[model samples]
Target: MSAPPLNPKAGLRAALLLLLCAVALVSITAAPAAGAGPGSPDSRRGDRTVVRTEQGLVRGLSHGSYTTFDGIPYAAPPTGPLRWRAPVPATAWQGVRDATRPAERCVQMPAPGASGVTGSEDCLYLDVTVPTAEPAAGKRPVMVWMHGGAFLGGSGSDYNAGRLSVQGDAVVVTVNYRLGIFGYFGHPGLGAAPPFGLADQQAALRWVRANAVRFGGDPRSVTLFGESAGALGICAHLTSPTAAGLFQRAVLQSGSCLTSFPRGALAPGTPAYEPFAPEAEVQMVGTRAARQLGCTEGGNEEVLACLRGRSTDRLATAQLMQSFNRPAFGNGLLPEAPARALASGRFHRLPVMLGTNHDEMRMFVGLSLAAFPIRTEGDYRARLTEAFGAAAPAVEARYRAADHPSPALAWAAVLTDRSFTCTTLAAGRTIAEHAPGLSLHGYEFDDPHAPVLAGLPANPDFPYGAAHGFEMPFLFTPFPTERPLDEAQRTLSDRMVAYWTAFARTGNPNSTDAPPWPALRMSSPHAPSVQSLAPEPGGIHPVDAYATHQCSFWDRLSR
Candidate 1:
């Protein structure tokens, strides 16, 4: 049957509906199964593993190849009077606590069609996964992961660290911090700092320092890594004075200090986005939120009390949560925006690996097409005009729609180049320029046939093509995907695991066995080298990232 013509209002409504559906789908994918504890039944009976933290003793579950300790509290829950305040250390407990089950995720807006919020306010937990077999004499390198959900949703427990632990020979820790309003809200009542979320992450790192030895990990060799918002969190930590010495190395995937979205890049009417907000702006939003919740009738303390008294359900709605999404600056946590700090050479001089996907914006643009159809040449031009303003004509000329399979693909390419690809390359160049002594590396995951994640509807014409978060499965096992990797993909996955772990162990990604990943050197005569990671034979090679992404054009536009 022929499809009917697209109506603007109907398309928007449908898009909104699909967006909600997408969130709900993600929620389902993210939720853990009914009684799957960290340890399996055999591990519970045969190989009981217990570790002692500063707080208390905890028992973990043992699988055949790895051991997992889940639901270990690193800090007290940010609840009641503690809302919007810095995370406090977890109080010591008596007796061995069960670390088999994952803790509730921090309070967050329920996914659309969900019955209620899926987590608790008291949710500052960290999970550790280590290889079952002990290393000869040296403690393994530790990789602490922070999950990404635009800083609004996501939990540490949702990811399974078995593969990274066993294959990479590393101890992996995943953390759950406060999210959305509970995590990032700033106001007159709240003292200066980045946000509770960033604070919670620091607390988690401290916990790892104190307890990593128990899990066969070297506290001094910890590597902090994350994708998207998580990577952005790493960016903040790199610039944060208080975060000095927390970790020795860092890895940022698909996000950088300079990451920003132009207006209408996501959808027809979506506004431009900045990851961080000034304290004053966040305070204004908090004040307005307080008024909306009927908490504005008293002094700052009284108003804070009123806000604290509100039910989690009331405060965790989607709109309220998104209102506090950006972390506030002008505090101890971040004295200035991270990008500005990086540009001024104010960030820490440490070995870093940062990169984005080959098609970072395809997932976003593909999801929005149902609601804001861009089916024709004119439609594509209109979107360019909305996003690039006066430069739209030039952008259209540069990324001609006739070159791509469809208008949607063309738009996605344009957004990807302008937003993620160029911005990340620029960030690497800036870092190389400022920290000339630091070893910096860049990469692009270009597995064109990477598995599609669960929940995103399949579109034949517009393949995901190594879109945002697609590279996650290579590092972590059992990521929700439509299909598992084949033999060739598995080989690539193994190589990547080796590269990541080698980098974590020694501030450099190249090892004797794997392909050599060149560093981003300021003195290099050639354009900066970025390793290409793909499944095909000879797929992993260095490319001139600047020329590939046409970063010169973006640099000019940005200036």
Candidate 2:
């Protein structure tokens, strides 16, 4: 089940593919009158049309003969006094809300390369894509997508569900939830709330449960799928009782429930898990943020009001200082660490599919390359030793410098395995042990032609490989048209859509025409079995991915 890299020549093509991946999360920012009219028909899709939803009637454009809906409010805007509170139901509209124009993205820090889009407090919105002419039939499976941006970045709007809806014939929903401090910060005044970002997501799912049937979806068969932070969110839902029954199946890409980057390991010598932050520590941070805003004790609603009045930029910037580690304890919704809950077999059992990219760390490492240059083997070994200590020597021995063309590539491989591959394997084993009856599928996306974003080195010789978030382009349309998918890659995209949508349709992802996907029985030492996805026609392979990556070491550390 090893996830090896493709030829470096393929990395150039992959760098060009980044634009399409960015398109997956692109959001249209024009706002209309409250309850605006129908949207203009998109010229690309044939036959313009409008559809009625529980919120209101929206007009959307047809692309490839599929209907699209944008800026649908699944929950009320978390503005004014409701900034950090749980999401409330969207107020009923007086007239048809134009679902055509996408709303401003949820208030968050500016993304890399994003321009002119000011963040706002009124950012709780969702977009929907459906493949049906009639909503009443409601036969299409519902797939909810969560974008991955380290829990600090990413938006539901970034992902375009068009291809998944049009080609795979499914109903796709993408949402924007609060991020950073605005979404996750918790304080004592809030009365034991944990990560409000996670709560906002649950609220979105609740909105879907209440109104999905109206939009050509089967609420009973809803499947939750997320990448990175979104995957972590799915893991939250799996454990939170409040999120139970909201989704029947889950697809976690490149992140897992056990994927916690410890803030401070309790005592200096304690094991990583032992240093897990408690509800008090999270509350302490929140209380401090509140105090900084001059919020006094008492007047709960008043304090919330004052905090809400603060500028969105200030809140986003302040939240970033903590460096995106906001999910914490105290909230009744998430009473315990997700990893702890999953380990004890206390989570809500459901069919699950989880995997990571081939070179997951390259997304981060490559971007930092210009700032943090790796000039020699000495530099590489120093970073490795700092991260893994005595174990660093063993890890370096396995992934030797000779194995890669450069020290940068070698370093990227180590981080990718530790942060992504190993953590995901731990999560899979926890699920398999806790819920043996549920269907579990594991995959490693190794497409080297995977997209890389702007600002990174574009040199064809610099190999980014199948880095993190590279799989996005194959699933969504690219923003910049420079690196559109070749025919073979498009076929790979089709297969991914088939696997994801098929999983949403039923517990299993197998179809008569699609490639056969084996259920995950065990990982690593148990067996050599994993699904491999690639752009080449015969590039797909199923082997022992966990064993190839030395996931056993991770499993031991996690234990």
Candidate 3:
């Protein structure tokens, strides 16, 4: 599982020791990435697919309505000596570079049934999708996406943004940043280092700011959007001073500044989850991790030198990669925890849309049900006690097992309300409270019959209604689903594309084609209006998120 190997670079000042050890990693040209479907090297290419970028010219694939350019490096590969430092500008290349295929994903934890860790450190690349009709410069909006894989796995190329580009008339840039230990690891030798993955995202935005016009996009109209870990990364930027002016609008789906999990949310006895960690705590963990790696013979610089020289096979173990999934605060990139900053009104003043799925935790609970079944009332009550502690009875009273079809479903609902739905609503409310004049919108993807997605093993008893990440295919075309969308779901997908693109273009999601989505009013005497998104007739309407999700009760419990 060790994959934290140093990527080798040519013609750059990589650490001296790395130059000797990792030369083989760079010199040997590998075969094309497996599963590089569609726009493979065998795909058709033409002059129309070629575009000049800040670095050089790259040729993509032409798909009539849209064009795609993949594997364009946004930053110098964070390999060898440059592993943990801030991303450096990509080196310019000569002639036309072939960009019809994607690079390796950042080193990651293995997939659901993989043999070992997959991906490479030399993976800081981005992909662009441009509508052919809007090829004129500065004519369309720009969307920068950050993929969601708990910050451990996922690649920008995995998502095909053609539907969003052609239908929404926007230029979409999906980016790949460092992941897991390679991205989030911290050490005392590094004095208050920013999360490399987040820094890579900003670097990509800066790339967009400088190069969007060439791709028929308006630089000033950049919209930052993502789901799950990607959405959480956007939350960090909402409060980051370095990220100021990098984007104008933000859309966070199923994650927020306040998103945290209680104990036993994932499995029985699992510790609570917080997306961000203190720098000191991360540094301490890093130091301990370094010692465990047998790099404890000297001071910070010497230990760092030893660590940098280690082979990827030595560092990419399951333990090391999973240990540093949380980003750290108390640094220039983040002055404080994003939740603290958001609560104190320190985030960027811009239009924001944040929401969660109606059955957000079904995906999680369904995945773990095989190992830790919650098949009975006793099982559900024990979980409630572990998560809610002294308030278990009250929470149970509010979300009783008899009210649901099964105890497992009841447990999923409790987690959805406590961990994701309520936290997202709270973050949205606090934003409204701070900037009453600014646009703040909330939503819930309320479709109870969404297709099984993301390769989850299915269970007949537990239906995975609109769960975490089920909304992705609607936003990006060709997302992996067990089956294609139906007539009504396809219509809903088109409307959602319009809503998302309209929000990107004008900071409002409403259009003449769909129902009106009003901004939330946190100060109102009654509950705020949160748009509920679904495929059924009369489904795409507003609901009282605070009241429906029982947020007031959860708020009091937290206090």
Q: How far does residue 276 in candidate 2 sit from its true spot (Å)?
A: 8.9
Task: Give the per-residue lDDT digits (tens) of candidate 1, residues 1-559.
Answer: 0011122245343434444444333333333423333543443354447877899888887776787889999988788777777888889999888988789888765666678877899899999988887674599999999988777778888788888888888999999988888888878877675688998999899898989887889999999999888999999999999899899999999999999987777666655778888888888788888888899877998999999999999998766776777888899989999999999989888899998999988887777777688999999999999888999998888889998999889999887888888888888888888877788999999999998878887888789998888898787777788899889999999999999998999999999988789897545524648899999999998887677777788888888
lDDT of each: 0.82, 0.68, 0.82
Evaluated at residue 361, the lDDT of candidate 3 is 86
lDDT of 2 by residue, 374-444 (tens): 66888777766656677778778877877888887887776677667877877788898878788999889
Residue pairs whose backbone atoms clash in candidate 3: 1-316, 2-316, 2-317, 3-316, 4-312, 5-312
Mark the regions of model 1 whose C-alpha exceeds 4 Å error after superposition: 1-48, 522-528
* Per-model TM values vs. the true structure: 0.93, 0.85, 0.91
Candidate 1 clashing pairs? 39-61
Per-residue alpha-carbon lDDT of candidate 3 for residues 1-559, written as tens digits (9 for 90 to 100): 0112232122111221221111111112222223332333431353557788999998887676778889999999999999988899999999889988888888876433356657899999999988877443447999999888777777787777888898889999999999877898899999999998999999999999999988889999999999888899999999999999999999999899999988767766456789998999888878878988899987999999999988876777655766777899999999899999999999999999889999988887777777678989999999999988998999899999999999999999998998899899888878988888998888889888887774576799999898877887677666667887888999899999999998988899988878999887778624658899999998899898788778888888888
Local distance difference test, candidate 1: 0.82
Lowest summed lDDT window (length 10), candidate 1:
1-10
Best by TM-score: 1
